[model samples]
Target: MKQNLDLAPVGNCSVSALIDRCGRYVWACAPRVDGDPVFSALMDGDDPEHGFWEVCLADLKDVEQAYIKNTPVLRTVLTDTNGSAVEIIDFAPRHHKHHRTYRPVAFGRIIRPISGAPRICVRLRPSADWGARRAEATSGSNHIRYHCTDLTLRLTTDCPVSHILEERTFRLETPLAFFLGPDEGYDQEVGPGVAATLDRTVVYWKDWVRTLYIPLDFQDAVIRAAITLKLCAYEETGAIVAAMTTSVPEFPESGRNWDYRFCWIRDAYYTVRALNRLGAVDILENYLVYLRNLVDNSAGGHIQPVYGVGLEADLSERIVDSVEGYRGMKPVRVGNQAHEHLQHDVYGQIVLPLVQSFYDQRLIRPGSVEDFCALEAVGDRAYALHDQPDAGLWEFRTIARVHTYSSVMCWAACDRLAKAADALGLADRAEVWSQRADTIRARVEAEAYIPEEGRFGASFGGRELDASLLQLVDLGFLDPMDPRQVATFNAIERDLKKGPYLFRYVEPDDFGEPETAFNFCTFWFIEALHLNGRTAEAREIFEQMLSRRTHAGLLSEDIALGTDELWGNYPQTYSLVGIINCAVLLSRSWTDVR
Candidate 1:
């Protein structure tokens, strides 16, 4: 199998693997998503042992892959030219055990011959030290232990161990099960254990999908996006990562590769909003605890834009010199430096999700006066720093500016808090916050808009156009019908539009011109069009965007406007959020469809 971006991800919320269309495991991380790479072929280019696990047929002719209905369990069928075929069922074990979610650090594969005399070979290669060293293996009758410097994985299999050890091709005779996990003995029965795990995992995912409030149109897209977003969440800590893989690059040799395994408060906020629109509250409920921990840890001081999934604070960025990058792109990075940048918009983002807990009675712990007080502390920061120069939402490392988007977000923070305070019957706090919101809004309108150009700029007293200006109406700083906003939208279309997609901005940043269109910004443009009474055009562009997704119905962080190829990290949560948001906005209402 060759390296491809059209891979499907299978995960249990703790760990995940990206399997190519040919049933080869291209990327997987052990222990956690940000942990050491156990299977790193996705980044290592052209190595003989490319740290992959593949079940290859000797005389393969065709391959087909799809999920098992609405579940995350993937099934791939490989057929030889001579009417012989085999089925590979791939999934991570996820089910309930002893009333607790049983998601171990393991990957499960079940191979069953579906047609006549299919011959196959199982190739399992894992690596350590960032793919610089191959793992050593020692086998027994029904198990093989692979030593990977810091950790070891015990592969418990029911196939002939000799065949796997020597990579010999053999005729398909019976079903085989393989479970690669931490060094531990297998359950009582290998076949039954795996079969039961698959059965229960299918049931678990399908049952969860049944609770969604899907739109009348684009139901399939919405469901797939929701499932992908769920897969990105680290359920144990309720921290949702921005994407699955790291350093996939935003462009070809653009050197914009980044590690998105950690949770960004801004990205998580958007993710929760999309899930909430689908009537999925479990994610929001789980994530509240993470926010609470961050608030408590802040000690009423500064807040970082990103953090480890386990709530660890420090994230020092560094490149792995030994490992080759994706498709031979260099400088594969591990950690993110955004954690140290001063992104004041996070104060507003932090409060947006936290405020939802106050009105939603379905949460385990509804917000109280104490909760409001804690939120006020965060809002205070937004109020004080709304005019300060920070990295902005773009995280421009070389320069800092007073971003208009950040100020509007601060206004939204105060505005939402005022509403929540009024709901809780705290009239004084509501009035105070409402006044502050008005003050911030006036400052934004005064400093961020250029009357000569009839458009709002990216920063205060500037004329450069950016895609984020489309969000002013969404933030409630301006009414959708306001002509000023219309001018801003039109100006953005004139300056930043690239065919069907939109550039984040037109000006040169630290890395010169951006190489591709940001996926989420295009979705935001669609929403802006819909809000501005251009529903027909919005629906048309929305369909066009949907058509660009991978065969598995997934989008990466960036898309090449010229070729429409997905770049950047795989299965980006922000892109998935765009799918849900656009589907909900453009789809016909359930009332009409029913």
Candidate 2:
């Protein structure tokens, strides 16, 4: 089978996994989101026998998969040639318990025979050391323990241990429940406990969805996007991952893959903003705590573009050669090297999200003057480096230029800090920041704008076009109808747009020119089209983008322009944020209900 992104994700914000169409647990990390990939089949392209957990139906004929309603719970039904079928319901247990939310680093699977008697084989193979070796197994009467170098996982199931250990085929007689968790004994009956956990998990998701203020139109799409974005968040530390799995190339053999399992300030800001639009303030509140820690730790110094979920700073990149990459591509990388690059927009991304805490009265602990004072230090760096060259938001590995988008973000930092100062009755600080914003705006207009081309260049005195320029209006840097902004948008569309998708840029970077269209940029184009009064065209393009989503109504970082194939990491938070943002932008007004 060709490697594809036709997968669904299940998690409780603590740990997550990717399940393929055939109900195999293809990828999951142990201990935490950034931990070892105990189930590493997603990255093991050459040898698929190990590093995965699957239930194989004898003589399999057809397979069907879908998420249960509003939850991340996935249900896959496999039908055999003889009409025997079985339903595999998979979810990670998450609900309220004791005095707090009970989300464990565990997976729950309930196997139910829904039709004729089905004979199935259980294949539970997990690897350690990045697929260098299969996990050693020890079995008991009802459970089996898989031991890896750094982690040990226990599979507590009601099924016969012999059938699982021997990978023996057996006739389905009754439902079976499996709980894969820490190396501990099961306190409750496996079947009953898992069933109860499933019930509560469903209720928990449904109740959470009820709290969202979604748009009237595309409610289903919006909810799914919202839930997927929520799943990307690591609640333990309030850091949101960019995507689930790593080393999934942007395009086949393109070598454009980068590990996105850690938290990027830019990506998390977008995720938190999208959820905040849905009135989901809890995520924002928790993320604020994470941000505060980052700010406090930095003490107004340099901040990396990305960090580990636990706020670890040194993310030195290394290649894991044991496992073949997606589709046998080499060099499955672990840590991201972007941490060392000077992505100046991070200064603004940090401050932009903090602006909400000062203005929003709903937060339990609203921003105080102390918070504003600390953020001013970030604003100082933004002002000082607004014109300096660094790796832009795209993180071009081999080049450095004073990108307009980065400068615009720096301007936003100062501008928002001015507003926050005004809100706090600090007139002196407000004037200081306002002056800094004006100075950056003047420099950007003078250097980034091309008078002959009647548009803003991607960088100072450069003529290249970038999709990030389309955010001129979104970031409050330019008016939607400004003639310069319009010309820039049209120039970008003429050069970078292919069919219904948009490329981040056409220029070749560290890798050769990007072969796939960026999903987030396409959405930005959709929003721009809408803002420019091309609502009809914008809606048409938005529908086209939506049609390109996977079966689970999710998108990756990049799409093959010619084939409309998702080609990047799985369930990208950036793409999910696009769905929510565009839905809210294009949906009909709620008053239309009358």
Candidate 3:
């Protein structure tokens, strides 16, 4: 009964919910990914009875949970000491209907008796105002409505409404279906409608997975990672969330927690890149639209590192004292303050994802010359601020420096813009961008590189080592075999590697030293090893990282070095991206399938 990130996520890209191991709806945001948490038990600490929904079986003895293969649909079975059992299946309905994707902001649950007669109690206690109070309810004959401060949710169920409303236990005689969605009347019968939705959702996910060009090995892992990444995306606005939940600390009493429900340009770029590798161009296509809108709105102005999925500008940070933090850590935050930080590398992240549309013929809407012109605006910003001191990709609040990674990403912006121009036969613009890229590269080589240590430091004229530097080769900033790049890799390993994991850095930041190994950085190390021709070693470490994933085959942001326990946000997109990228990097090619 301990709280953990060992939860399964079910969503349709429009709405998502995190269900605990025992089939409890712990966290779910309504309206959108960044909206209010209707079920806030995940962050309620010790007092969880008010902000959760669950179906409890009397005399429960055993339980089991798993996804319905290649889909986000989850199935959980509860068995009691009397040998009676009941099965619960959960999902958010999404499928192609009426020539368009029909994804509702809804969740569907179907419960059926698997053996003998099982008695169960339906406990649906939603909260409002960040768990300050329980939502008031009004019930109809076949449905019950919970009215929160901002919105009202309707639970339409075929089960005895009185049983659910009064929290009474009932004997399971027939299958029951419950649809929690917008406060609207459902058109179809609950049982048949939910069963049909389940069938369609399963088919939709399986069909989507079939299109992916999976590796010969770890196909299941890669597919699950890909689906989880897809779930993190808000399809309505084409924005991808960093993670589903917020305020989950990086370590115990670490005070390093932040809300990750919004989209970070850098994280979204990596997510898009990984999915693109698997031939899942739909994500790339959707994300490109999001980036294009972001660029257009900026109009060559400052761009924040993160933004609301709906492109809201100001995300002032605020703490919800109503709910205690995860595990009573305190200060459960809603909005993120990092939106105001000057993360200069966002310019390159903007351009990196946009540059692909110009060349990928599979896209329904390819990049136009006008799109290239808009991107040059972003490239201009990259060139103008390439050397300026700013918050690095790590989002250090109290420190600002001329991070090498930021400058290198600026170089990449200009470098890719030049290539994009060349593809369009705009030699003049190409020359302009190419020269800017060369100038930035020369400055980085001259200032960021250390002669005595023979490696690039985290910041210009600074000697601190950072794991982000491991991305030099992956970012096209340096050749994998470059002696300088190799030296930096060695120094990072020597300084930051803790057994099978890699810490982002050893130096203390605003929250003291990082207490856990960053999951994504370890994957970067694995990629570095593979690129350096240490295939056997890389594969060994990759397997170790795989072994560290949660029971749902997902990873959080950080892992405790000593206990190997997951910390930080749940189902982190960055960690999931690492899984797909490393599998693609280390897996045998399809030619070896025989």
Candidate 4:
């Protein structure tokens, strides 16, 4: 049953869980949550066709992917050349809502066959530690265990086959086949009834998804991304991974690779908002608990910008040379070293969603108010160290710089804190925070803005344009029509645009050398343009971004300016959220489009 065996296929290293279509098998490494990877080497590897056990993708000619409502179940329909088609559904359980899915995955389950009658096959060959962890195939049963002290995974295939791909260090995915003739044959063969387990899995997602209140339009994309994000999230801890794979090059042929399996405070905040907006308080609240634990666990001195998916903020990253990277970029990395940077504004970023919880949803109770009080206490520390230089948003490896964007977000922190405090009737403290907010805002305006360039630079004493400044217009730091906002937008258009890809800033960031043009920054540019009354331009920019989705309706973190190959991880939920949110911002505006 040799169907589609990719011997040497490219893997997505940018974000985890992105399926390299050229490679075929989906790659994911999580449960680390902090960017410390559990899986590695996704781009392209030595053995093109890979797998200890093959995951048979229902022979698909017409493959359409989507999520099931509000849950994170990824559904794809595959039609074979024989016109026999099946819908393959994938979703690593989001946070355990009703205590159903145990063992919250650093890297976990991939459920298949939701609704279809195609001969289905699955080949699962998990390359642990980016293919470094040794494996001991359990005799008899079709299960293999990757030997690791911190990491444990058991993979089973539903099909009997020659598991040749798993024998050597290879790239791409190994092959497997499913013959769908009649009567759940695969189901009867496996004990405990595979059909029943699959059914329960589907029910698990369905019931969980039903708990959320979806939007009127763009509901599908939102729920899908939201759910996908949750699936990537470790259940007990609300840490959502940046992606699943490691060392997917941000720029093709350039050694600009990074792993995003860890959970970021920033991304968690976005998850909060998306959940809050979608009317689900559980995940958001659980994430708050995760943060509380994270803060409690590592609350001593300085806070890292991100944490492992399991809530460990400490991650030391190094390169693995056992396999070549996607398209020949070597030395794919496993852990993230961003744990040792001074990202003061990260507290503010984390606090934003908490602020939203306080102001917008009111789901936060009185004890939550106490939580704010403690968080505000930390704000005092930030105020004391605000003027000092530190790593900016990108968390660069070099010496910290006076990143204006960090300062700007720091201002936002105070701004949100003041408002939240005021709402909670702590007006006196609010006033003090408000005064500090004014100071930060004044510093951002005075120091970050380059009047000569007619835009804001990445840092104080620097004169390069940044995409973050575009948020000034959206976040209302500056009115969309203000001279400064206009100037910043123009400068971003001039300097930051790399074809369709846009950089967060023109200057080099801390995540290693900036290579691929960032995709979400482009979304921010569109949001700025739309908010600034340039509706058509925003629409055009948005269209360009939409056109960049892979053969799958997914996006990567960045895009190569030349090959247009998605740089970074595949199926980035943040990028999709950007596209969905921005599209909604444009299409269904409450205000008139200028």
Candidate 5:
């Protein structure tokens, strides 16, 4: 029998390949942040029969893949059945080194074919909501026009268009193609092409990534996460999106899903620090610059936990129930409703990036009354009820639990406020914030840590455990060696651990169904185990976790246990970061966890 050949989309590891029945390639296209999706696998699972990008089996067997070292230049080597090979490289070249997205704009993109003179065939089928609308295709000597609804796509290239077919009927074997930036510069629609713009994209990605100062050992996935982070960061505004998609379910058959393409102030804190740890000080610093700008603006009080990629604070959801789920998770939601939730934790989440940028780079912009007011306002919110139940870090839609994690972060908000104020000479207010911070700390120690149980609870006076509490390593509240820290870590290992995987929490998750093991929780476990002197165990589990990635090293938020299918949202930033941070930490020593 012939050995089975699989074309892995995420191409990082061998095991996590999300193989369709006739799996070939996957498609990803997220519209302007607040805009509705143009393409979504999260809305419906892989339907290779009607996918946007079709992969030929011959392309799988004959193709070799690698990135241009130190950059995101995706290079693929394809050998035609006629016994000739071709090299194709893809990347989007931008004028600015770092883009800070404030308003949505078209990206500067290009794809170049280099090497072997084999005839190439390509198809451009741009879909709206799972091939819902049929685009009209018209041919020009140098371009192909595809129009659907209000959206129009024109494909132009230096490559010759030999066998041209239209929207539903077009297919071609050409040597090159150019995706225009704007109609303005093209003569009868001429812009950048494959041959002329290759070098530009190559230099852009490599140079931007070269600026990173990564501190720990980077594995394939860790490096990939760092690169993914770069991709999600809008060059126009320093805001980094939490993920690259909307409506991708954590579990496929459930109605539990939310949009992740927006810049979340809470998530942004982790993003900046993680990026900073890699030595990309510019991302956080510039992002801080953007935040300072927001802080100074009068509309800062209208702050939501998240914002559109363009900084348009307006966010609403639509139910596209007609579409199916990715692997069958459903009733797809397009906008984020959490945008309207009164998340008190927002105060701490925003404060972290502020305090970190100040500490990591001494990057305090010229302070103004507005900045002071934003800080004071957030600080005022912090002092109101450090010990009370509010939406925790998980942001569950049901009744609020007395989440210890939320309370810890609440304490963090007050602590950072006092720290920043004292550092900058707000001496009088320092005591007030200091007292507030102390009160939260006392509350956590008194009510959060349970001595009889020899462990910390996920919420106040609760018996359940959550992986999030492991975050104290980053917060400085608890040393990894402390008994409660060790106890908490051990407790997590006992409850959250299932084989090699970890759950987000041991409690009931309201996401409509149980998901494949949570991705970030797994990484957090590795970090906890490693920090608590379980390095050997952490290393074993870390190595095991890495083994599950698809051929391209891509991962989803959850993974199915039965078939080990890559489930949840695709290419989660936090998951990638967690894996990377753990790999880096372990590369130094597993003796602590050993």
Candidate 6:
């Protein structure tokens, strides 16, 4: 319960909450992932008295936590010094109900005694206006309704309301259930409905996990990562968020925090590819809808780097001065400004996922002519802007460059479009796109490669190395074994590499040098190493990275190279994608064992 950082996440796709080891609901957004945090204690400084919902044992001694096997449901066992214990089952209700996903803006918990009688107290505090105001509470016999300015939450419980309101310690006689959601009264008994939802939710998650094409090795790690990725998705609109929390610093006092609760095209592309490899087409199909929506709404113009989970275009960035950031890292940010930048790589990210629909017959909605035509407009942007400068994938605030990675992705966009066109039997369109891809590839090789240094540069002509260059092999711009790629890998390892982790880049930016290592970049380096015939080394490094995950088998966006501490947002989609991808590449095939 005393653990400060390295928090674990639990959520249904619609909403999520970060629960600390002390069995406290520290952070949760309402209605949607990007909504105002109803429980904002994670960013409310070190105060444990407000902005949180917690069930505290009067004489707590030991605490142990884990997920209900193969599920997102979390189980925490708290043992009191008096030799009494209670199990806390926490989850967001998610299962099939009435022919659709029953995920709601809700949080549920059941506390059952596992040993002798245990004394417990409940602290339920929800906030609004980014922690500027606490919810006004009103209670009846079995429920408490907390009303905020724009939102209300009803806490239906099986325990006495007096015990909760007065914070009185009571002996555990029967299992108590609490359900928090949109301030709507329950039609049935709270205990039975929550119990049944727990049963079904467990089945739902296990059944989904069974469908995964997980590798023989690291199956648990891969499955855990996969579950986090699924939780990060906004299922209603098929938009996948980059992470659950926002503005957890990338490094101590480095001022490198950003809101990651929105969907980044590049991050979604990598996330879906990982899920696709696991044979999870539902996520891919849903994300394609988000992408298609973007293309349709683009009005035949450029696509932004990021967007709201519900496809809102203008995400104006601002800071919340009310709530102190995670670990008192001030300037808690809400909205993202990356929505206005022209990150050319998005054009390719959009096309890459759409390309899969054309060939993968597993998808519910395969590629059609309308989809192709819409995507053609996206490809047109990639071609026209391939040589131009924009905010790179890193989204540097002050600088723009024709980054090698962005250019390579543009080439990938045209290249995949040509292939998709040919598959669709549009020969003329295929020819034109093929010629365009050739032109882009030629330009990238001529300008992105540093001939004097015998390797590819981060920008068109600069000599700086970037971890994103690890993507050149992935995008098919260069062979993994090509001499230039080999040299580039060597240079990256020599410069950006810190132990087993890799920094995105070391150059000074508006915020000074990025002091932390990007977790996903290290995975990219492992893949590159494996592709270049360092298969054993790749497996070793891959294992080391796996060891870096939190106790919940999840990772944040960035890690401190100096202290090996997780510093960024929780359950980062990119970090999980790295886990899935590296496991797929390095794990030995089942055929080998057979």
What TM-score would every model get versus the actual structure? Answer: 0.98, 0.99, 0.99, 0.80, 0.84, 0.98
Best-matching candidate per lDDT: 3
Instruction: Tell me the lDDT of model 6 at 64.
Output: 94
lDDT (tens digit, per residue) of candidate 5 on 1-594: 111112222211100112222222233443343443333333445452332433232333366776666555556666656555555554444433346311112222233334344544454444564445434566677766655333455656553544435223222234444552222334533333444445655665567666765534544566666776666676566777776555666654566677776777777777776777777766777677667655555243644667766666667877776456555556666677777765666667777777764344345454444465577776666657567666677777775777787777778889888887777788887788899999988888888878897888887888777888888767877898888888888788887788888888655656544656887788888888777778999889888778876555656677666666665555666777676677777885435445
- Report, for every candidate in turn, its global Cα lDDT versus the true structure: 0.90, 0.93, 0.93, 0.59, 0.60, 0.89
TM-score of candidate 6 on Cα atoms, chains taken together = 0.98
C-alpha lDDT of candidate 5 relative to the true structure: 0.60
The worst-scoring run of ten residues by lDDT in candidate 4 lies at 4-13
* Candidate 1 accuracy as TM-score: 0.98
lDDT of candidate 1 over 304-340, digit per residue (tens): 9999999999989999976778888978998999988
Off by over 4 Å in 6: 1-3
The whole-model C-alpha lDDT of candidate 6 against the native structure comes to 0.89
lDDT of 6 at 177: 94
Cα deviation at 334, candidate 4, in Å, is: 1.5
Better of 1 and 2 by TM-score: 2
Write model 6 residue lDDT over 227-346, tens digit each, in one string. 999999999999999998888888878787789999999999999999999999999999999998899999789789999999998899999897877878877888898998879999
lDDT of 3 by residue, 1-594 (tens): 568888999999999999988899999988788888889999988557688989999999999999999999999999999999999999999999999998998999999999998999999998898888899999999999998766899999999899998999989989999999999998988899999999999999999999999999999899999999999999998999999999999999998889999999999999999999999999999999999999999999999999999998788999888888798887688899999999899999999989988999999999999999999999999999999999999999989999999999999999999999999999999999999999999999999999998999999999999999998898898998999999999999899999989999999999898889999999999999998899999999999989988778999999998799999998999999999999999988888856
Over 4 Å off in model 3, which ranges?
none
- Once superposed on the true structure, which residue ranges of model 4 sit more than 4 Å away at CA? 1-26, 30-52, 55-129, 141-192, 207-219, 298-300, 360-367, 452-454, 508-515, 589-594
Question: Candidate 2 lDDT, tens digit per residue, 1-594?
Answer: 556788899999999999988999889997887788998888888458789999999999999999999999999999999999999999999999998999998999999999999999989999888888899999888899999657799999999999988899999889999999989999999999999999999999999999999999989899999998889999999999999988899888888778999999999999999999999999999999889899999988998999999999999999989888888986688989999999999999999999999999999999999999998889999999999999999999889999999999999999999999999999999999999999999999999999998999999989999999998899999999999999999999899999888999999999988888999999999999999999999999999988988888999999996778888888999999999999999999999988
Of the pair 2 and 6, which is ahead by lDDT? 2
lDDT of 5 at 219: 45
RMSD of each candidate relative to the true structure: 1.2, 0.9, 0.8, 6.5, 5.4, 1.1
- Candidate 2 ranges with C-alpha deviation above 4 Å: none
